[model samples]
Target: MHPSAFLRLAALLALSLPAHAQEGMKQQPAASDRVKEVPSIEAVGLSGLKPGTILFTDHRDDPAKPENGLVPYLDWGRVRPAERAALAPYAGYAEPDYLQTLNGVSKRRHETLKVYVAQGRFVVPRPADSIDLASYATLGFVAKMDPVIKHKTLNPADVTPTKDPAAAFAKRPDRPWCDLGTVCIESRYDLEGKLPLGVKLANKLEDGASKKVAEFVSFQSELRTLPPAETAPLAGLTKIDAPVTGGLEQTIFWVNQILRFGKFLAVFQPMPGDPAKTVVTTYMALAIKADVLDRKQEYARVPVLKNLLPAQVLMGNSSFNTGTSISAGLPTYARNRMTAFADALAKN
Candidate 1:
């Protein structure tokens, strides 16, 4: 299948499924499971919401309490059989192996969440297309060096338009794995013994004749190293031996992704309280993908089971259902992340 087609399918999976549907598809948890289930909110369906009005809600999971965090939302069983068949020949689709390693990050989880809006108005520093949205230092994640991966855009001279799907897919010169029309980021903390966690942000905005709509979606997942005792699952299966080499520090894998377009957009409007300043109200969807395990020994043994497994599961009970406090900080953190973006836009 064409890479673009794959992306389209991913987007479709992200948008079409409801929150309950997403939760239902996960590997069923045991009766003793205590993972907290949080409600999902929709920014677009809020009452009195107009076409351009931005509504925000920070539905988040606490990182400090890794145990209570949400599990992954996507699984192969949820996918249509035809769709799975089409992707079966791809690198990660057929079975669990090293080929699933796209770039440096593992493509193990296919989780997604809906976009929610947060309160505030932001100024678009420059044209959306011109801004370096993925500059980590500029966004306050990393300093000096640009940690965000950069991909070469398809040179018009290199691409040949064709009616044939196979020819078109093969000739497409654009970075096939890059998120085509969205801004995406993946970040892991530098320090060791720090939960092996990562934050993934992927968002998109659509412009209508008179108004523009934007969706901000994020996924937080755990990236744990497999324990020596967990070799039972790897017994018959071919383990991709392509592990990163180097010292302990060198062996640490960092998250990376190609950022496409910026999802941040601002519109001027007068409202109660702050009428003069540009209050950046962004639609943010902060999702903690549910990571659950039924029996003690299930570790994604098959393609279907792999979808049910997430790295967080390896952390044991600590990474299960979250408490109220974990989600309590979501609204503030969501606002803070977007605030940094707005501030950067102001300086730009």
Candidate 2:
């Protein structure tokens, strides 16, 4: 690291130490001891016998030197022509653009970056028929986000979004959060019912061997995360119980949230090398609230912060990761969420 960068990071750590110390005064574990738990895509896949992949497909960053060289980041624009052609039909809209920048966020409310994208691929060997395409028709797409409070269910209805930000703030009403001008909440849908205005969608997939057409399912719902609390961060995770779309086998899911918009999909087909096993190709893209990047770019630009903090920062595992800037938080969350979704589909 450059001397200047080291100084900047040191200053940041120094500035944040007092608050971390203050929290310790409350009798909770030391900030460094806290660890948020998240379902790892790899772990989930192995648990259900599935293969998964996560790549950083962001057009803005250099793939040669990802945040820590461990984070999976891929940009649609950066893909080679041949690889791009292979994934084009399925790629759809999951690539990120470097040019948009999403600048002017805090200063002028400018959204310079066209999007903050995330991508993941996974394989579920089970035939599409084994997956519960119908029940997913009314599922709460937010549940699979698998980052904050993690997976709670497929239900979407019975969740009423809170419109009063002040009231939500009051629920936990902790000082550091309000003092910081924001909070994170959890999206936990455990009830069963039809999502408001949700609809069932069907699609056709050709069986490569038989040349026969098969049916696939997708659905949409108006979902709300569980009420705000200290344990799970939900503020801005959704656009006030945003309307989301999802599906099973040949899986797809998209969420429209206030802070971030995410879309992920997996295409299942027979693997060429092994005719008996199925190969699933997956992709996803998303955009985040510009103003956020504006405020936290300093912390996000740090390498150690980006690497060690992605999953922790996202799942709100600890107050420290929760407090660090999460500008590059999507990849870890994406990988885990995609795997969780694939595992669920494999079971159904």
Candidate 3:
């Protein structure tokens, strides 16, 4: 039997064994099972203009545990099988081909959206009474729609009085629909030893006159916390002040700085002749705080308190190959930063 086939057989045998017996069997640990299970939130009717039992857009009226407040909604109406073929050439180490293909196609044509929710203890402290909660949530992904183009043909015979048959034949009308694509959504968060609760919703939005609406939605499973081991890595990084813009630019800047001064080859390596490849992947950390000002006091006179909502980080890999490729180191670097930031946040 082929070595790969033998390995597969061995894996099957090991997995088929009783739980106790399998534990006794010795083998190299499988790649840490960090791959998370995407949840299905839409099937239970969690997405709509109004918030419902499963849906969460109406947080003001329908509040859930802070730790279970987020949801990911995915719309795949615009995704076609052909587009997947166009992406095969670009799929690899840090470049999981399927994910890269999905990302490439998603960049051009809208397909999926991943939302996140918080599932841990959080507090919004106030002067009189503090609001303590178990979860928090937000829309982590938004994709803008692309425009469509249409083509029209004009006839030369209509302009001239000439009765030439050739002119009439050459003036055939032709019209083609301009293909503008849809939107994409992706969310990232740390599993720092705490089982994070999350759900994904997928559906189609109604088509509008100027732009197509999002539709064909589906969501992932229900909220669940991460096991202790998974949450451990997130306990390291320091949480700094939220940046002015919550976009990926700030994270990119920080990763670039670490690459330049930190000199950590295991985390980052500069690609010669390519400026874009030097950026390491960094997770976007987000915190939501709520404050109620006193009417009797002036705006500046009121005290402000901080509340750490469900922290979310947008995890994306940067290509060192001039946008052509990605490396494994990007995620490794991102995880390290998340750990450090989480640690710092806990301290503060």
Candidate 4:
């Protein structure tokens, strides 16, 4: 299974554990441990990020030169006005159309997309005394972004937008179904007269395929339709509760067919020696399954005339073979997002 799917399954399983078992799970290393300890921007071969400026670049000062590579860093409030303006549109969060653009790039099999990762950091100016996580949350920054962070169902057109120059491709989806996060799991739906959405969706795919293939597609289809709150086994959730916590790890699940399983994370850490300043980093990890061509050779010569076969016959199937290519661009997307977030934060 892909890592994202595995994590989703694990989360579901953990939610069903008894209270004592849940407590034991919490005792283990916090999920925050997964956050990489990036060096301060100064030590990473870069300097002079203005106190409130936000910059986005690879961990390396120069991607082509390893000797001058810089490690990831998350600190300081040095974003510039121009930069902030550039990222403002992205600051609103969950731009499904923008995500579709990245997904579109990955779908181009002829492009030979390779594994990619990018890391960046930014600083948000804080009141002089409000530096800790608690203070930051109390200030309403988290609340302002809460709804924006959740997964939103987008129109299929957003994924493959029309070419009309006058079209409005940026309009938000109406009545987007919440698929993940606290808002989704906590919301009460009026299902009184409606069939269970999951079963209704499953029955739609039960036709027109061999048993094995039908079962596979059906299962995936169901996952895309069911709310993560319903499919995931998480317990102890209340309608009034906000799943977010300062300095805690949270996940937003993507439940689209083209992109079967993926995880998006955003973390906020306090800057050292500056309690009022906070460093926020966002991470995205995606797993896609697709088919690609691989070069291979297979003998086309018949047994009786093998020795007499022409070169072309002997080289049949040598040109290319079909195989799977799983590319990861989530990290790059996350880095781009952080750059924008920093800029937007600076302006705000």
* Candidate that would win on lDDT: 2
Weakest 10 consecutive residues of candidate 1 by summed lDDT: 245-254
Q: Model 4, 344: alpha-carbon shift in Å?
A: 3.5
Error of 2 at 100 (Å): 20
From the highest TM-score down, the ranking of the candidates is 2, 4, 1, 3
C-alpha lDDT of all candidate models, in order = 0.27, 0.32, 0.19, 0.28
Error of 3 at 57 (Å): 15
Work out the TM-score per prediction. Answer: 0.27, 0.38, 0.18, 0.31
Error of 1 at 221 (Å): 16
Candidate 3 matches the true fold with a TM-score of: 0.18
Q: Indicate the TM-score of model 4.
A: 0.31
Error of 1 at 139 (Å): 7.5
Q: TM-score winner among the candidates?
A: 2
Give candidate 1's error at residue 120 in angstroms: 5.9
Report the lDDT tens digits of candidate 4 across residue range 131-221: 3433322213332332223233333333221223222332324423232322222111111111122112222323332221111111010
Q: Write the per-residue lDDT of candidate 2 for residues 213-302, one digit (tens) a residue.
A: 111112222222112241022111211122112222222122222132333444444443443444443444444333433333433454
> For model 3, how does the per-residue alpha-carbon lDDT over 1-348 read when each residue is reduced to its tens digit?
245544454444434444543232112122223221123212222111121111111111222232232222211113322211111111110111111124245332222222222111111111101111112111111110101111112132222112333222112133111111111112122222111111100001111223221211111111112233422332221121111111111111011101100111011112223322221112221111111111112211211101111111111111110110011122233333333322322333
lDDT ranking, high to low: 2, 4, 1, 3
